[model samples]
Target: VQMLWIPFWAAGIVNGVGHYWGYRNFEAQDASTNLSPWGVIIGGEELHNNHHTYPTSAKFSVKPYEFDIGWAYISLMQKVGWATVKKMPPKLQLGAVKPVADEKTLEALIANRYEVMAAYARGVRQACKEEIAALQARHADVSVLTAAKRWLHRDTEKVPAVVLPQLAQVRAAHPSLDKMVAMREELRQLWLNTTQSREQLTADLQAWCRRAEESGVAALREFSLRLRSAQA
Candidate 1:
């Protein structure tokens, strides 16, 4: 029974369904997901996406909405001096807006890239709402947006191959939304390029922020302000 439960259930089910289905807390590079926010089964392994995001974290649950039973047990052990925790996930904080994107801003942006991108996802959703309404007012074809909307918040590589044409169409139709999506990729490049010096990245970030704030898109401008306030 132990052999079956540990090897078969734990090894097979968690690894299988964990990669295949469920909501993601963080957009981990791989397809990992939380089995449930109330992670009651298989210790804390149900919070599989959280596990992938912070592989070394002893506590699996990160969000306020999530509850990991294994983390509860770990806390109990900690109270009894039976356990010790080491590394946990990094936090993304927002402080007073900086005058410019400096070295510290670059460091914070890179350190919390995933969280930063998730916040950018919110800005993308806003772009969607604004663009969709504008298109409706003009009586234009909204199918392009309907296609692009599903994948806009996701990474470029994660966008479905078939939907690529629709995304292109979206760009052609809506100039404001086009600028937002293109800027999203430009923002991602600030961290993706490794050869650039810290100073160079800071300059690049400053340039990016200047462009965003001046882009004429209200959502993009607000997002730049939020980006300026990010802290490590």
Candidate 2:
């Protein structure tokens, strides 16, 4: 009964609290998160976000601070000739490249696109918060600013239609905030352009970098430069 109950209970909580609680390493479309970095209990299934981030990987731990006891057990089992590791996540290799993105850049982008978006989203959220705080200080307009911050990272459909006006208002009021939000969308759309040819994509990326730099948004320009140099 322990065997029956334990796995079922673990699965339920992992699917529940794992989605509702803890810090998300990646801003996944779904609200999946790591229950804990030290995944020793429940056979290391606590690292659910890492599992979702690299679904094919048998080892769930991704960071230096993380530990997957299940992976350790699998290694021990392999050493005793009772198990075998099958798959792992591919490494994201970003290297220097020409001004235009190449095949290697596309490959690397495809492999780690989610990670790229996650980082962009986090940066935008931080910038948004700082902007909102400044707005609240200057105008004592906590309600609108607070709502803007709240829905900043949510899925577009999840945000109330009424909040759209407030977002536009905030954007009009803050140049830096607007630039961060627009840059995030541009980065997302760049990857979504499947119809574009390789040459077109490379050209688009180069154009994006130029616009980003000219916009005078420090974070956006820095990220664009990083993207320009990225390769697989």
Candidate 3:
């Protein structure tokens, strides 16, 4: 809501007081009328009945010499390229227009809007799944490091040759244990950044299962078992 006020306090006071004392300008059977020659300064004061009679007129002042303050502001805004006024079409201007949309049309519009939104949501979910896959791959490499540490602590001299190459690969992939730890932190932050609601998460999980098949299920179950074992 925007409001424009005239500079003069007397104008404002007259606007408030003139409504009851003014002479009727139209035969609308209403008690409203015009107050003064400078009707613009007081924003068409006491002209309710005249407005009811000719609501479509851009100018509220019925008389040629009457001034309209609201029109002055509208002119200023137009000069500054800040406003554009579009007059209503002829039928609507005459108050003869029917409703643009019926119940079924409105329902179809709403359904289409939801369908577009659902497609956008599905795209976001797919992007998140790709990011999660990258995180899981990083987690796998970190798990290898963790396994290497366990083996190292058990007996560093007795470490197997087959596992030695795998340990070296893990070490080469992640220069330090701290790098793997940082990757884990980054993965957690990425998960936190998701805008997915509970319903969206459920949908994403179901989609992921469909895309990844048996490998996805086995990997998730193995990770779950490892987490429980670690907790124990």
Candidate 4:
């Protein structure tokens, strides 16, 4: 269990170093800062103020006193033949010359950005659900009419216009609509197949009962005795 803590500490150091001393590209309202200090051990707990500004960053150490315990453990593990240390991707590592931003400004900016994105996602999902429900209702209406028309004409269109339009709309609104529809259809077919199998099994059981009814009681008794002997 102590070994499990190794990764946590390592991650914390990276986060601390990035936040405390690393440069902030954007002007976050919060003082969440970054450390620019080179080397592993110097990185420590990313200051809370800096994290509030740039929470997504990986490195935490920015100053000399900010010693990262996690990075130290990882280095120890690598030396002891138990672990490997990989450098952060070039995209994640900071440039030496970039300036750190104030903590309060950074925090407000990040918070506002999150709120806007979340609101937009929620709004889109709500609108999609409503549109899909309306389309389904329209499809049900056309299905009823189609059944009635088929009774009179005996020939119906292969695909209904309502279904086609609804499908197109759903596809446009939700990129995963096709996958969802396919999953639903697969589940429906599985249910139908299960029902058919259950019906066949019931019929088979009834037929077996009928055959048993025709068999002599003496034959059943002998079969029971044989079963008991086998178990023994």
Candidate 5:
């Protein structure tokens, strides 16, 4: 009974502490986090973010510095012919390609949309922070900058109604912000436009990459270049 209860208690910590602490490798919408890179006491369950990123992966440790005791145990069991790993998530590989997105690009984007969105958010926040600071410095009454920060990653529908006007003001002041917002929405819509045929989707994705590269924002351009070569 003690053995059973002890395992249950430790597993419970995977949820309670897992979602609230540590750093995230993938920016999943949920609050999931890794409690520790070294999954020592929790049977490698402490790497919750990696687990969420690749749910079917038998090994949770993603970074070079991380350790997965559970995966080590699994390897030992497999060597003894007692265990088998059915599926492991494929890693995304990028290579030089034409300037347009192709089927492989779409596959990679679909598999790693969360990662792209997280990167997009970070880029936007960094850009916006600089813009807001410049605005505040020029105009003492730039209190609306606070609202811009709050509405950083929110889509138009999710942004608070009261803050919409301020957000618009910020966008008007920063052309980069407008481009980032448009690029984000375009990517989201591209993914959701499932009714389009494969050929059409490929064309649309290629067009999206073209626009992203021409957008003049460094992050968007870099992401577009990366997208051109993405493969699952």
Candidate 6:
């Protein structure tokens, strides 16, 4: 059993529970999921979704919060002349905020789309909490706000079907939340359509920033400014 233990755990637990549960950094094709952000348990196989997305990359962790023990081991080995690492995860570098989002902004945002989306998701959650508090003070029905905060953290498609009507109610009831959800989907378009030329894409991104800034939502304005800081 000792000889078979490691392989059995790798084949069964890693590939089994790895896909069946946990969060994803990228929108991979398959159902692969990262079993945990701290990859000590499965020796970095916990970052299964990242593995599926970047099969050739030596690193598994992509998000800043995630840790890959396997990559740490590889790094130690390389330092000692025992291993070589070629491909690695991409990173988003932010620079001074530009007057507008340009081609460089578009390139960086696309290159680090997962990280960008995660940041946006965090922004939405923060905004929702503020909005919810304000609404509660006004004696509004704040029950929906709690659920809205949870569902809004996810992409529109990822939201459960059963909660669509509730989400619709939340949108209809709250102006700030409604605008945030609508603008979140619009932000997604910057990377989704690949048919557009660089000039066209840059133009689209510039226009997106303008709309976001003028949307009257403070969160949207801040997010747009952050987008302007993306450096390729």
Collision pairs in model 5: none
Question: Whole-model Cα lDDT per candidate?
Answer: 0.83, 0.74, 0.41, 0.37, 0.77, 0.82
Candidate 6 stretches with Cα past 4 Å from truth are 1-7, 24-32, 52-55, 62-65
- lDDT per residue for candidate 3 within 9-85, as digits (tens), equals 33555435544556544333243456665664456543544454455655565556766666667668978998775
Please give the lDDT score at residue 110 for candidate 1: 90
Q: Which tens-of-lDDT digit does each residue in 1-232 have in candidate 6?
A: 4334547766889789877789777656576888889887666777999998888899998878999888898999999999999998777788899988888898898888877777887778888888788988989878887876778756667667998898999889878878888887777876787788989989988988898899898888998898899899
The positional error of residue 118 in candidate 4, measured at the CA in angstroms, is 0.6
State the lDDT of candidate 1 residue by residue for 155-218, as single tens digits: 7787779988888888887788789889989988888899999889899999999999998988
Off by over 4 Å in 2: 1-6, 78-83, 132-147, 153-155, 158-166
Question: Candidate 2 residues 109-181, lDDT tens each?
Answer: 6678876766667666777777767766788666776778756655566568999998888778778878777
Task: Judging by TM-score against the true structure, name the best candidate.
Answer: 1
Q: Which ten residues in a row are the worst by lDDT in model 6? A: 1-10
Clashes of 1: 0
How does each model score on TM-score? Answer: 0.89, 0.79, 0.28, 0.21, 0.73, 0.86
Over the stretch 109-210, how does candidate 5's per-residue lDDT look in tens digits? Answer: 887776666667877888877776787788765577666775656556656688888878877867888888877888877677889887787888888888
Of models 2 and 6, which has the larger TM-score? Answer: 6
| Top-lDDT candidate index | 1
Ranking of candidates on lDDT, top first = 1, 6, 5, 2, 3, 4
Q: Count the backbone clashes (under 3 Å) in each candidate.
A: 0, 0, 3, 39, 0, 0
What is the Cα-based TM-score of model 2?
A: 0.79
Better of 1 and 3 by lDDT: 1
Candidate scoring better on TM-score of 3 and 5: 5
Off by more than 4 A, model 4: 2-111, 140-232
* Candidate 4 CA-lDDT value: 0.37
RMSD of 3: 28.4
